[model samples]
Target: MRLSMPWFVRLAVIVVFATGLQAAPAPALAGSDQPPGMIAAVVARVRDSVMRIVVVHPPEAPPGEKTMAKAGEGHPVTRIGSGFVIDPDGLVATNRHVVENATAIFVATPDGGRFRAEIVGMPHKADIALLRIHTGYKLPAIKWGNSDALRPGDTVIAIGSPFGFDNTVTAGIVSSVNRDIMETPFDDYIQTDAAINHGNSGGPLFNINGEVVGMNSVLYAPGTYSGSVGLGFAIPSNDLRFVLSRLEEYGQVRAGMLPFRTQSVTAMMAEAIGSPAPGGALIAALGPRGDEMNGLIQPGDVIRTFNGEVVTDPRDLARKAARAPIGSTVRLGICRSGTIMAVNVPILAYDPHPQPIQEPGPPPKMLGLQFSAAEGSDGTIRGVAVSAIDPTGSAADSGLQTGDIILRVQQQPISTPEQARAALQARAAAKQPYAAVLVERNEKRTWIPVALPGE
Candidate 1:
């Protein structure tokens, strides 16, 4: 049986939303004092807007088949996340990861009504997804806050479905701000002590004034199914609001990208190179036959700024550049070969669908690691092999080198990138926070532990 929210939650919602302020004061519990009145009021006003999202993926058919088996196909697979109403027209905002590949999405409000949703737009790299529900009724819209004004130690509230518990509220202080957690290339997250769990993914994080400040998205945990540990992160409303506006206007996000990979240079490396790094990004390499060759950026260069924003770290550069509009010429400040130079870069929109190939192709470079197919008649494994190495990639940092074949991930054997993705999904469903990939490098074996994206 489906359980409804407790009566107390509804009453609290009425008291706070109706008065728009804290109640006079609660009677002291025999010789004990109650918590702050303002904190309690904020939670009540925001809780009702938080929702539970139950996403269903279409079932699979036999290999090489396009349709589902009429009788043999199992029930539609479902995953639970969270979301909130963004506009009065029934428009809702959620994490792209939540609705990606969902065949059916159900948004359940605190009032106990569930409505079907249609995905309007989603930018995978930005990790933002927008959905619309045909509710045919007026909805409560949240006031967006200025994320730029946020500071460390600010009190915040997270509202969402935790373990399928709809409208669960958790309060905490902003542990930090402007943290460059590498979960997303454009990640400039607001770190909070709020408890964000598996089902908390698309929920709203509110400031004390009842405005939506950020979106609860990720947490640092040992495994997926683990509960809150006081270290959770949210995508700031400032960036998300920008993406939301673009999505509403263009039906997609147009972000600029340089065909290059970079990292922050340490003080020691900067001293050795005689460059005043001051912790800016160092250009490592460029994409092959891509826009980068158009004289945008080069290797052994220190990037100082992107479009006038100081690039204090590699993540900062990536984040600022990613938010730029596509087709716009962005100015970049760099120190190349001991000479400070400036270059104009054109931003381009990346394609959601990669070109399809019938037969297996050469290796692909991701996060700086180079991979190719394994040799032998191993029918179980089939993918572009890893033949090279990126000494700066997470794989390389985890001790992966040349001649390594990625055989299994999280203990599940994989023959292709698709299979590896499936293994990762399985681990995610089980609430496994991190994954370890077992690789065969140089005819030997070892494990490369990588944190899953957006976790």
Candidate 2:
């Protein structure tokens, strides 16, 4: 807990606790009434561990190509950020946004030592990323602190290169903990008034004991001002440790997925369902994403707790589910039909972004009828996707909807919108009455005899 004090008394509060020895008098500040040497001692131990990150973004690639140019792509953009060493062997932690899409990453030390760094871990659920550098010399690593023990009004120190100024230090009290800035699903941030700005994206936020408690990732600035207005947020150290550990072991973190879709309990729904309070996850949908439950669970079951922890709502359960280990059975408290019972549910691995299947033919283009093609990552053309349709148009009248992909027309396979248009134009010249349009919607295919215009 923090002892709220005047601006002038902060240095004294930390200095007194840092150096509790009675043998000698501590050093004093040059011109201030507050005592000194505590902040200096803390920065002295961890500043060398802090690094200036310089990232070179790869050139924009032409459609379906690795990169636009062969070597030395022109107009390479550079981004600067900050990071701190977590392992002596050169494992550095920073925000993923700092080095995202970076072709090459470089790190510089306070002693002018520089080396190329590589991204080791980038988790989808968390904004944190890990980088590794090789160096023969011994490196200074920062000490880890318990973010769970932190509370509002606790003292904190931020170190980073704000606006390209290296080694800038700012001090403030933690405005709050467990602060959800709506950044991520598992957002538990340490909100402080420290002067964090651009270029401080990945710097470390240290506690009064000089231990690294969080990493400065984001800041708030009103209006057109890009500079700090004393509002900064850091990802808690406890959250970072889990991602780091998983990355080191599995090369990626696996988020646990729930079998059933859930909704937040409302006051009216709670009273109707016999729940004492409007808190818990209400199972909204079952049987599609929920087939794994094996009919043991049903819809309308309110999950009151997960693995013995009382859930505040659906979001709380989601956050807890992400942290749970996959392939493990978790005990859930359920309120169903006015009876409270326990149910064991298995956690599954979540695949957030799955690649779409490609069509294995020509490239994509859109012309008349607002048709576009879906292209896969490896240059393979997918089916022609319908982006929009006129409500009064024949396509919409024949059951074609947005997000439906045109698979074939008139019993001919079509890969692109250009192909679909060409085939239809030929069929129109032949004066066909109705075209058997095969379209895929939501992974299901159906034939719709769309009436040809001017027929």
> All candidates: CA RMSD in angstroms?
19.8, 21.7
The C-alpha local distance difference test score for the whole of candidate 1 amounts to: 0.66
Which lDDT tens digits does candidate 1 get at residues 1-455?
01022210100010111234232221222112224577678777767677778665444556897754132233334577889888878889987777775545667778866666777777656666888777778788888999888887677878887667678777777888887655555667898877666678888999878899998877766543345567788889988898898778877766556666787778887876656766778888876535544866778888887877888888777767667765778888888777788988776555435222111111112233444556667664444355643322222223344556788887677776567556756765665434687877655778776433222
Model 2 local distance difference test score:
0.71
Per residue, candidate 2 scores C-alpha lDDT tens digits across 1-455 of: 11122221101000011234232222122113324666778878778889988665444566887754222233334567889999999998987777765555667788866666766777755677888888877789999999989887777888987666688887777888877666665667798877677788789999878899999987776665655666788988988888887767766777787867777789999998887789998888873568787676778889999889998876678778878988899999999877999988888877556322111111111112567886656877778987765422333234466667899997899898888888877876677645778998777999976545443
Q: After superposition, how far is residue 96 of candidate 2 from its true place, in Å?
A: 0.9
- Lowest lDDT sum, 10 consecutive residues, model 1, at 8-17
Clashes of 1: 13
Candidate 2 Cα misplacement greater than 4 A, ranges: 1-37, 59-67, 70-74, 263-273, 286-288, 296-299, 352-455
lDDT of each: 0.66, 0.71
